[model samples]
Target: MRSFFMPFAIYVLGLAVFAQGTSEFMLSGLVPDVADDLHISIPAAGWLTSAYAVGMVLGAPLVAMLSIRWPRRRALLIFLLTFLLAHVLGAMTSSFEVLLGTRIVAALANAGFLAVGLAAASAMVGSQAKGRATSVLLSGVTLACIAGVPLGAVLSEFWGWRSAFWAVAIVSVPAVIAILCAVPASAVDPNAPTARHELRALRTPRLAVTLLLGALVNGATFCTFTYLAPLVTDVAALSTNWVPVALALFGIGSFVGVTIGGRFADTKPLQLLTIGAIALLGGWLLFALTAANPITALALVFVQGTLSFAVGSTLIAQALYAATDAPTLAGGFATAAFNVGAAVGPVLGGIAIDAGLGYRSPLLVSAALVALALVSYSVARNAAHRSNHSRGRSPESF
Candidate 1:
């Protein structure tokens, strides 16, 4: 029964995720055009991205609380409809303020969709397959980074930035249809915990620590990633033309890393995190030292990208496992944590740059954050082991 329904469920959910991620990231490519069209400066245009991130940080828990008792399929449908409508508004808007508002609405919808999609995908599988299922869903975002962003940039270049928004709305129409047709309208569990209960579940020490680790991991990755273009052109002394190529390479590395990470996450989550930490330490150290050379910079960028995403599936699995009593709320909180880190990482990196650190300094900040994450993870694991031992059980019993 699990085998038969799981694949179809994951596939439909992945498509929905692809649609949401495309909307989220395509804005990166359209910011300049948007600034010009709306008579705003580029930095002011950048707030559109920040607005979306803030929406995600706030919306995940808010929407999760509101819809926790609703049927997953129904909630998903509502979220998708909201997302599509927001994009339509975004495309048709003439004022920058209107566009910003539309983006915030869209991101709120995206956060709801992602949280529900992750929980539903994991529920379709046994514990052993949860990691793989999550990876499949997240692949949507990775694929968006690789192809959707570049294509959106191209469209904006030839037509207008609004064209790209219209295209996303158009593509999302089929995705909404796919969800309706392919996903079953299952009944909600009668004994399922309420949103308040789920929120309480977050008080577990291991769950709290794991969520913190997840946030730090994301902060580490985005600290450098948000500044990658400047580092490439200013420090690596590469042509500005190479920025897109470098982005594509990083996307490729992310795809591969997520694929590999998903496979081992269920059975060897601790091992996966350990390896990811080591990779981050080594990769970023080399990246910081070699940014002055184009060849070394490119090679290390791909490597760092792979290592950066290596813990993604495992981190989600860990959070869900720790919060098994309240999976939906846990999932929402995890999404919020990641977005919070995404918003904060860039600010921290900008501060470093303002303090007279070179462009390569962000990579150093990335390495330090990852190292701290590794330390935090070790402490959590040891404490979990001690608790298990006191109960005369192995930690693996989890």
Candidate 2:
């Protein structure tokens, strides 16, 4: 703990993950290239992204449980190496089958990195610093939306689509080195868990609620954001130039909210969620109304990204409290929810858009989902409060 770089290890891990994320999402813009190269349709090429997310959801908990008994630092190293190798495989492969296989392999490795990295960051810092620590680790994800994916877009624009994979491979090497050097060895739990322990953790009602809530919450947000570029272009009447700025502002908001939200969750989880949930509804309402106004619409979009993303850390904290018996499994499952949303959101949003209801439909749907979540949480919180009162204990006693 005395090591100053110990906490900063979160940042190091963030960069490595940023590279991995770029590798996964960079394919969005490369759909045309993949289609032409593989003699497939643009829609078919989108499967690369779908395959990766599927692998993440499928791989997350399984890898988390298996790797629990291993040292966190060592597990993280192996995960990074596996991620790097997947990029290399993509770089080398010409066959679409090979590419899909490579992506699924990379996704499995990425899941391990995400699950272990967050847990490691938590173990490194004291309870008081959890908010800030989670913020630092989460900043990587924010950057993925801001810098990493955009940078990969640049790579595809200038170089061939395949070359983007090479760039990620090159970038990941230094991140791996940095993580290995910066992350303190003694900062890991020696006794992570066995498969039996992780299974026991998943049975808790509170944990299940939190994880399901995480999935629903994230799906609500991404259902809107996955179509943001199109919204700004078609509705906001802006060129692609401003999309980067919009995403950056949103990422900054999310990054800031993480620190603030983490602190709030630590002291006032229910109150903070209610406030943010209210704001989330307002944010979408503004986006839906002013989506034709570029400046205001961008601001509204940024608001959605910020408040919505910060909800994750709060939910993670709630899940941790629920699964006191098996934090590792809960942590990994929570991460999986984020990936699940990543998969479900875009598909649903696309269908809504295709039905001629237009791009703003996703925003409306998200607002409704958030409203439902708010109501659900209220009931759950009240029940827990009453249960605690009957036992002559505090709701925070867990």
Number of the top-ranking candidate, with lDDT as the measure: 1
Return the lDDT, model 2, position 182: 87
The lDDT for every candidate, in the order shown, is: 0.84, 0.77
Best by TM-score: 1
Off by over 4 Å in 1: 1-6
What TM-score would each prediction reach against the true structure?
0.96, 0.92
Q: Poorest 10 consecutive residues of model 2 by lDDT?
A: 1-10
Per residue, candidate 2 scores C-alpha lDDT tens digits across 1-398 of 33324356778887887887677677877889878877887887888988999899999888888888777778888988988888888878778888899999889888888878777777677554454555666667777767777787787788878788888888889888887788877543556566797787679666777777777778888888788888888888899988777777777776666666666665677776778888887888778888898889877876777788778667776666566566566668877987887778777888888999898888887877787777777777788788889999887632
- For residue 29, give model 2's deviation from the true position in Å: 2.0
Sequence-dependent TM-score of model 1: 0.96
